[model samples]
Target: MDIKQRNQNAIDLTFQNVTVTVQTKQGKKLLLQDVSGICKSSQITAILGSSGAGKTTLLNVLTNRIQNSKKVQVNGKIQANSTEINFRKFSEFGAYVMQDDVLLETMTVRECLQFAANLKVQGDQHEKDKVVQETLKILKLERCQNTLIGGQFVKKGISGGERKRTSIGFELVTNPSVIILDEPTSGLDSFTAYLLISELKRYAINKEKTVVFTIHSPSSDIWQLFDRVMLLIEGQFIYQGKGNQSILNYFSNQGFNCPRLQNPADYLMSIMHQNNKNAQNYPIYFQKYDSLLKPYVEKEIEQGEKFEILSYKFETSFVYQIQQIAKRSLNNVKRNPILFRARIIQAIIMGLIVGLIYFKSEGRSQVVFFKLIVQILIYLSKDGSNHPTSIRDMNDRNGLLFFVCINQLMMSLKPCSVSFPSMRKVFIREDNSKLYSPYAYFFGRLIIEIIPQIISPILYGLIQFYMVGLNDRTVGNVFFYFLCLILNSLLGLSLGYIGGSIFSDVKTAVFMSPLIFVPNALFGGFFKNRKNLASWIRWIEYLFPIKYSFNAIAANEYENTHFIPSPTELLNLEFSKWECVYILLGFIIGLLTISCFCLVCNRKRQQ
Candidate 1:
C-alpha cells in the first residue's frame, strides 16, 4: 500500500497558474492563489489543511465545479492527459462526491445501486443488474443489499462506513476514469476511514482511475495511503509532493519539528495552522515549496503534451432515463409509509374541519370567503388581522363553494414544498453524475408526486362534497372539483419545487414557501377583488394558479343557479366550467415547466 499506484496510460491532471478570486461585500478575495500541481492517474492525491485553507476550493477549480459568476474571476490552465480541460467533455467522465452523503433514505442499499446503474449504464435489465451486483460486491455491501439506508425518522439501517461506500459506489457505477471526493470519511471512525481509503486506493490502481479528495485530520495509517499530498494554509499551497519521510523531512528542515510517534497528518495540520497564524514574522512555507518544488511541477506540465478533452458520455437514452427514474420514484413512494400514507390522513383531517364549517352551506354562502381566506392565511400569520374577511353578507353566495378549491390549493402547497426540498440533494447528486437528464428526474418525480396529489384530494373532496351537502348535483361538481384539485396541487408543488431547488436547505424552503404563497392566496379572489387591483399589479392574477382554480370552483357552483343575484365581477365567473378546467390545466403545465427550467438552469450554473 505504501507504493504509489501507477498505470502508464492513466490520465494525468495538471494545472498551472490557477487563481480563483470571489466577490464579497467588502471586496474581491482570492480563495486559491496561483496554485499549481499534477494529479496523475492511478494515484490518490489528498488535499489537507486547516478549515478555510481553500482545500475544497482547489478541488472545485480542477474539477471545473467552481461557480462561474460575474462576481468571481477564474484564471488558470488545466490540462488532462496532455490536452486542455473542456468543461462539456470533462463533465462526461469526471465524478465528484460531496462531503456529505446524499442518498434516498427510503431505498435499500441494493435498490439504490440498481437505480443508479439503470440511470448510468446503457444496457438491458440484465446488464444493469450485473453492474449492481458487481458494485455491491466491490464495495462489500452485499450483506446489506436489502437493508434500508434509514434516516432520522425511519428505522435505522447500515453503518457510517457502508454509507460512505454507497456514495463512492454511486460514482463507480458510471465507471468514471476520474473521481474527486470532498472529505469522504469526515464522520467515520479511524479504522473505517483506513478501510475506505484503502478501497479507494484499489479503485485507482485496478481501474486505472485518478483519485483526488479533500481530507481533514486523517490518521497516520491513512496518511501513508495517499499517493500524493497537498497542504494549504490561508489559500496558498504550503507543500505538495509524495507522502513519505521526505515530506516530513521537508518540514523538519524548516524549523517545524515532528515529535516522535506523532501522526504526520496532525503534525502537518498544526504546523500549517501555526504558519498561517504567524505568516508575517515566520518564513512562509509556500515560498520554500515554490523554490524547491518548481522544477518537478514544471517538468510534469511540460511532459503533458497529449492532453485532450474527454467527450461527454451518457450510457442511457433520455427515454430510458425517464422510465427508470419513474419506476424508482414509485418504488421509493411504495416503501415509505410516511411519504405515501401520511398525506392521506392529513387530507382527511383537513376535509373534516372544512366540511364541519361548511356543512350543508349550499343554501348559505356568506361565510365561504371568510373561512377559505382564514384557512389559506393560517400558516402565514398568527393573528386574524393577517386575513381581512367580511362575514357581514349572508348573500355572499358560493363563497363556501369556492372553499373547496382554496382548501385543496393550500393543502397541496405544503406537500409539494415538504417533499421536493427533502429530495433535492439526492436529485442533484444523481443528476450531476450524468445518470439521467434533468427532464427525466423532473417528470418522473412529477408523475409519482401526482399520485398522492390525486389520492389525497379525492379523499378530501369526496368527504367534503358529501358532508357539506353539495350532494344534490355532486356528480358533475365532484368530477370537475377533483380535476381542478389535482391541477392546483401540482401548481403548489411547482411553487415548492422552485423554492426547494433554489435554496440549498429545507429549512430555508420552509421559511420562504408561506411568504411566497401570500401573494397567490391574497390575489386568488377569495381575499380581495381582482378587478379592483391596480392595472399593473393585476397581472399577478394570471401568474398564480389559485385565481383560476377558485374561479372554476365558483363557476361550477353558481352558474344557472340563483345562488346570488349576480356573481361578483371580482369572482370573474364569465367562463364556462370546461374553460375553467382548461385554465387550471394551463396553470399546472406552465408552472411546472417554468420550475423545471429554472431548476435545470440553476443546476447548470452550479456545475
Candidate 2:
C-alpha cells in the first residue's frame, strides 16, 4: 500500500528534541541527546548504533517507555500523525516488542498466540482464533505451531529464530498502528535475521503500519530491507535519512568512500567505533546531520496532517482475563506433570515414613498403662478391654500434632517460593502488555495453587491420622484435623507468595524465607510456651498462622482425653480449637492481601 492509500489506523510516529539523562554520582549522564526522527506509515525504520550508543534509549524515549524520575529525566515531543501525545495516549496506537523474548515457555506457538488473542483481540471466539491463525501464518510459525516454547531448564523445543519470531508475533496479533521493537534480530544467524527483517518490511507495507526497531550490526542483505535509518554515536544522531547507498553516498560526500566488496553497514560501524583516532569525527558527523539532513525531517513534520487518536483500553473483560490466565496455567500444569506429581508423591512417601516411624506409639503406650491399671484393679475386682491408645500422654499427641502442622506448612511454602519468583518475569511482561491486571493474574495463580494445597493435605491426613492414633477417630475430629492441615498449607503458600512477590530473584526469595518463617515457628507453642515468651514479644504468636494451626490440632487431639494434667492448659493456649481455626482463616486472608499488595507495588515500580 502507498502512503495515501494507507488504512485509517495508519499513523506516522515522530519525535524531536528528545533528550534523556540518568542521574549518576557524577551527575546528569546523558543517555540520548536531542535525537530527532520520524517513522512514516507503510515503511520500516531501523535505528543503528554500537553498544551503549543510545539507540534503544531513543526508541524507549520516543515510545515514552522511559519516564522522568529522581534518577532519570526525559525531555521530548513525541507525536503521532503530528499530534503530540503522552505515554498512555501513545499506548492506544503502539505496541512494543522487548529485546528479550519473555514468553510462557510451557505453551506451544499456536497456544501462545491464542492466549494473547483471547486477552488482546476484541471479538468472539471465532474472530480470536482467526487472528491467532493469521498471526501464525504471517510470522511463518505454522510449522512449529504445536511445538512448546521450551527454555534452558526445561525441554528444548523451537530454534532461536522461531522463538524470536514468536515474540514479534505476540505484538503483531494485535495489528497495532505502530510497532516498535528493541534489538529484534540480536540473536539470530545472518539468513534468519534477513528473513525476520524481510517479513517485518512486508508486514509494514501490506498492513500500512509503521515499523521501527533497533539493530547493532545487520548483514548487508538485511540492511537493504530498511526504508529509513537513524544512526547514533554516544547519544547524538550522526545520520537520519534513507538506507542502502543513500547512507554510503552521504558518508562519501563527507570524504569517506566505501571500500570495494566491503559491506557499507560494517564500514560505517568501523568509522563510528574508531574512537581514539576519530573521536573528533563524531561531532562533525552529528553537525552535518543537524545542518544538512535534519531540516528536511523538520519540514516533513511541520507539513504532516493529524489523524484521530484513540483512547487506551484493554481488549477483553476482567472475568475473561482471569478465565484465560487460569486456563493457560492449568494447561501448563498438565504439560509439566513432573512438579505436580512429585508433590503428591512426596506427601505420600513422607506420610508413610512418618506414620511407620511413630506407628501407633501413643496408642500402644496408653494401652500398656491402662492394662496395668486394669490388672491392679483385678487384684481387688475385675476389668479388661482391647483398644489402641486414645490421647493419654500429652507429649506424644502434642508432638504428632505439631509435626503435622509444620509438615504441611513447609511442603506448601518451598514450592511456591521457588516457583513463583521463577515466573515473575513472565508475569511482569504480560502485566505490562496490559494482557491482564495484577488481580486477575493473582487469582489465576491462586486457583492452580489451591488444588494441590487441598489435595496433598487430604492425602497426608488420611495416611497419617489413623496410623499415628490421635485422640478420637470421630468424623468431626477427622474433618477438623484435615481442615487445619489445609488451612496451614494455604497459609504457607500465602507466605511463599509474599516472599516471591517481594523479591524478583528466586534464590534471594528462598534464602530470605527462613529468616521470616523460622522466627515465627519458635512461637508455635511447642518450641516455647507462648505465655513464657516476654510480654512485649508474646503478641507475635497471635500474628503467626502456624501458632494458631498447631494449637488447633493439639486442642482437637486433647479435647476428650482422660489425661491427668490438661495438655491444653500446659500448652498455654487461650483459644479454643474452633477459635484457632477462625484465626488461621483470618491469617490466610491477611497474608494473601499483603501478597497482592506486594505484587501490585512491584509492577508499579517496574513501570
Candidate 3:
C-alpha cells in the first residue's frame, strides 16, 4: 500500500482521559492521572519529562506493553486510524524500541542489518542485500559493518552509540510509519548524541515518519531537532506544544524570568523541581498549565490535520524469516571452522575413551562396561561429547545436537527447563512479520540438529562396541545399541529445545536439563530392575527412552554368554529387540510432538 493511501485522517492516535494507578509500598499511586493526547504522522512528537515523570509508562501504554492493574484503571479511548488499538494489536502499526540494546552479539553489524532486512522484505537476495546496505549507510555504521555486536562474553562490535543506531536500523528496514524510541540518545557523548538526533530529524523530515521518544534533559542542539515537545510531571501532562517555545512560554506566564545565556534543558530541570526553595509557587501551576494546553491539542484533533499519514503496507513472509534465520545459522557455522572441528575432535576423543576402556574384558565385566558405554552415550546425548573441554563449554555450544536431542526432549516432557528464554525475542520478531508458522521453526530446528546429535553418540557406541570385541554372533546386538544411543540423543534434543523455548536464559535452561534427565535415568533401569523398583517408578520407566535403550543394549551383550542360552533366546526377555526399538522410537516421537506443541503455545503467548 502507498503511504498516502494508508494515511487516513481517522484519528491516528488518541488518549481519552486515561488514568493509570499503580499500587506501591506507599499506597495506591496514580502514575498517570486522566492523561490525554493525540499523535499524528505529519508531526514528530517528543514525550519530554524528568525522571519518574511516567513518560516511559505513557509510552508503554501507547505500545500496549503494560497491562492495567486493578488500581491502575485506563478509563479512556485509544484510537489509531479510527480503530481502537489495544495492547495486543498496537505493535502491528508501530515500532517501539526500549532504552536497552538487545542485538545478538555473535552477528556482525552487516549480518544484523541483513537478517532484519530479510525478515521484513520480500524479494530476491539482491534486493534484500541492497536494502540492508542502504540502511547501514543511513545509520553511519558502514565503517564497522564487519564488527560483532554485544553479549556477556563478547564485545567485538563498534561503540555503544553505533549499537543504538543498529537497533534503529533494524526497525527502519520494516519502514513503519510510527517509530517510538525510549531515550535514543542515552549513554552517548554530547557530540555523538547530537549527531544521532540530527540523523533522526533528517529521517523524520525526509521520510515523513512520526518519531516519538522520551529523553532526559537534551542539549540545545538536540532540542532544536524536535518538531514538537511534551512536558510530563509526575505522570501528568503539563504541556505539549512547539519545541523550546513551549518551555519558555510556560515559565513566562508563571512570572518566572528566563536566565540569560543558560541552556533551556537545565532551566527546565531547575523549574521542574518540586522541593527546590527557588521553585515557583504560581496558583495551581500544574492544573492551570494543563487547562491552557488542552484547547490547542483538541483543536489539532478536530481540524482533521492530526491523524492523516501515509499508509505503507510492507508484507513480511514466513519463508523469509525462516530462510533468514536458517541462512544466518548456517553461515555462522560455516565461517567458524572451530565449531565443527571441535565436534569432530569430540567424536574422536569419545571413540578412543570408550574403545580403550572396554578393550578386553570378559563376560560379566564386558557386559558391565557395555552398559557403561550406553550410559555415556545417554550423557553425550545432552551435550554430544566426552571431552572435558566440551563438557566445560557445553552451554555455549549451539548445534542441531542441542536443538533436537537435548533441548527438544526436555521441552516436550518437562517443558519448564529445556527451551531458550530468548525464544521470546524470536517469537516477537516473527509474529510482527507474520512470517513462518511456529511448527516450521520447531521442525526445522529438529531436522537440522538430528545429524549432529545422532552421529557422535552412534560413532562412540559402535567404535567402543567393536573395539571391546563383542561376539561375532552379536553384531546385530551392537547395531541395536547404536540405534538406542541415537534414539536417546533425539529424545534429549527434543527435550532441550522445548526447555530452551520455555526458559530463554541459558542458566535456567541448563539448570532444568537434569530435572528432566533424572526421571529418565532412574526409570531407564539404572539403579534397580523395573519390576523391583517402586510401582510408580516402573510406570514412569515405561515412558523413559533409557529403559528401552538399556534393555536392548543389555540383551544384545548378554544374550550369547555361556551363562545364558543363545542370542536368540536372550532376545526373548520380557521385551524383545523390536519392542525396545519401537518404545525408543515412540519416546522420541512423543517428546518431539510435545516440544512442537510448546513452541506453538509460546508463540501465541508472545502475540
Candidate 4:
C-alpha cells in the first residue's frame, strides 16, 4: 500500500501577525504578540522557548482552543493554504498531544493502540489488529504490549518515556497531516529525549507527515534532529528559520561569540534572561543578536505572504469513528480487572452492612421500625461524621434502650459533602471521543452501576426484613421493601453522577454531593412529619426521590394500621400497598429523567 497516496496533502498552516491578549485581574496580559509562522507538509518545525514563553498559548490560538476572554484579543489570520481555518477547522486537520498525558490508565499498551486505531480507521478485525501492531512496533513498545499503564491504583506499565511515545502513537494512528505536540520530551531523560526527537524526525521525513512540537532546553543530540526552529521570548517571536548552524552564525555575527567549551543550550538560557536586572551585561549581547535577526524575520514574513494554497482531498466516514469508539470502550473495560473486582467488593460489603442493621420486626414493631428509619435517614444524609451533640445523646440512649423513640435532630452540616471526583476522568475520556451519544453513556452507566447497587441494597433489606421478626406479612411485602431500596440506590447513583459531571475535580465534588443529599433527605420525611413540615419545605418533598421511597417503604410496613380521614372525609387517609409501589416507581423514573436532562445540558455546553 502507498501510504503517501492514501494520506491527505495540500495541508499548509499559516499565521499572519497573530496576536493574542488576555485581561487579567491585575491588568491586560499579552500571551502572543504579533507572532507569525507557517507549518507545512513534509517538514518538522520545532517551537523552542523557555517555560512560560507562550508557545502553548500560540498553539491554542492556532487550534482555536481559547475562548473569548475580556483580556484576550486576536488580530491575525491563521489559514490553511487559501482557506482561513478557525479553531474548529484547525482541530479537524490535526491531533494535539497536550503537555499532560491524558489516557485511560486501566488499558494495556496493545489495547490502547487498538482503541486509537479503531477510532481512526475503519476495517475488519484483522486489519485493525495489524494497525495496532504496527503502531506499537513504531513506538518500540512491542515488548510491553500487554502491560497495563499505571493509574492511581495500578502502577505496572511502561516507563514515562514509553508513555509519551504511546500518546504520540495514538495521534499517529489517525494519520493526521499535521501533529502538534506540546513539550513531548517532558519528563524524559536526555538520552530518551534524543531518541524521541530522532524518531519523530525520521517519521516526518520518511512518511511525509508534518511534526510541530514545543521543547524547553533540548540536549545537543535532540537539537540536531530539527529541520526548522522558531525561538520565542516573552510572547514574541525572537527567531524563525532553518538550521542550527544558521542560528549559531546569526549570534556570532552580532558579536555574541560562543566559548569553545560552553553548551549552546546554556548560552541560549543566558540570552533569554537579558531583560533581568541581574543580567545587565546580557542585554547588550541580546541587542546585537536581535538587530541581526530583524532583517531575516522580515524577509520570512514577505515570503509567507506570497505563498499559494495547495489542494488535496481526504476520505473519512462518521460510522467508522463510532465503531472505533465503541471497540475502544469495550477493550479498555476488559483489560482493567481491578475496576471490575472493586465494584463487586463494594456491592457485597454494602449489602452485608445494611442487611445486618435493618433485620425483621415483630407485632407493634413501630418503635423498632422508627429506629431503623432514623438510621437510614442519618446514613443517607451524613458522610460517616459524628452526629451533633444534640443527636449524639439521643443515639446513645436509643442504643441503651434497644427500643425506638421519636428523636429530635440538630447537626451542623459541612460546607461541602463527600463526592467521587475521579469518575470525571472516565467521563471526560468517553465524552471527548464522542464514543456513544450522551444518552447511551448515561444508560450504559445506569445499567452497569445500578445493578450492583440494587442487588446489595435488596439483599440487605431482605435479610433485615425477615430477621427482625416481622408478623405474617406476605412475601410480596418483602419484595416491595426491596424495590424501595433499589429505587433509593438509583437516586444515589444519579446524584453521584450529576455531582461528578458538574465539578472538574474530585475534591470539590466530594464536598458538594452531601450538600445536595441533605436537602433531599430532609424533605424525604425521614426526620419530621411530611404533613406538618413548613409549606415551602413541603414543596421540596415532591421533588425528592427519597421522599417517595421512604413513604412507600413506611406505608408498606404500616399497611395494617388504621388512620383518621381528612376533615373533608372525601379521600382515604391511609396509603395502600399498590399505591406505595406506584410512588416508588414514579420517584425512580423522575430522578432518572432529571439525571438524563442534566447530562444532555452538560454535553451541549461542552460542545
Query: TM-score, each model?
Result: 0.84, 0.93, 0.82, 0.79
Put down candidate 3 lDDT per residue, 1-607, tens digits, no spaces. 5755544522256666777787777888888878778776656677877788898888877776666556555566676655677654555557777787677666788888787667656578799899888888878999989988746535455789889998888777666667788998899888988887887777776666668888887888887777788778787777777887666877788776678677777787676665556334523556676678888777765553444333444545656545656665565445543434555456567667655754543321233344655644543221111211222222121111122233223323333233346445645555544445666566554554455666666655556554554433433554665665677656666666667766657677778778767776656554555557666545666766666665665554444344423332422335865787887787668777877776677653221
Global lDDT of model 3: 0.62
Give all candidates' CA lDDT scores: 0.73, 0.80, 0.62, 0.59
Model 4 TM-score is: 0.79
**Per TM-score, what order, best first?**
2, 1, 3, 4
Residue 326 miss distance in model 1 (angstroms): 2.1
For model 4, give the 10-residue run with minimal summed lDDT: 404-413
Pairs of residues clashing in candidate 2 = 363-389
- Candidate 4: segments with Cα more than 4 A from true spot: 1-10, 274-360, 364-420, 423-441, 470-472, 560-607
The sequence of per-residue lDDT tens digits that candidate 4 reaches over residues 311-408 is: 22232354554444445445544665454455445545544444345332122233243365544444332221111123333233223111110000
- Among these predictions, the greatest lDDT belongs to 2
Candidate 2, lDDT over the whole model: 0.80
Q: Where does the lowest 10-residue lDDT sum fall in candidate 1?
A: 379-388
lDDT of 1 by residue, 284-385 (tens): 676787788767777876775353544547667777778887888787788776756778987889888877876654343233323543433442212211
Task: Tell how far residue 217 is off in model 2, in angstroms.
Answer: 1.9
- The candidate that achieves the highest TM-score relative to the unseen native structure: 2
Q: For model 4, what is the error of residue 343's alpha carbon versus the real structure, in angstroms, after optimal superposition? A: 6.2
TM-score computed on alpha carbons, candidate 1:
0.84
Cα RMSD of predicted structure 2 = 5.2
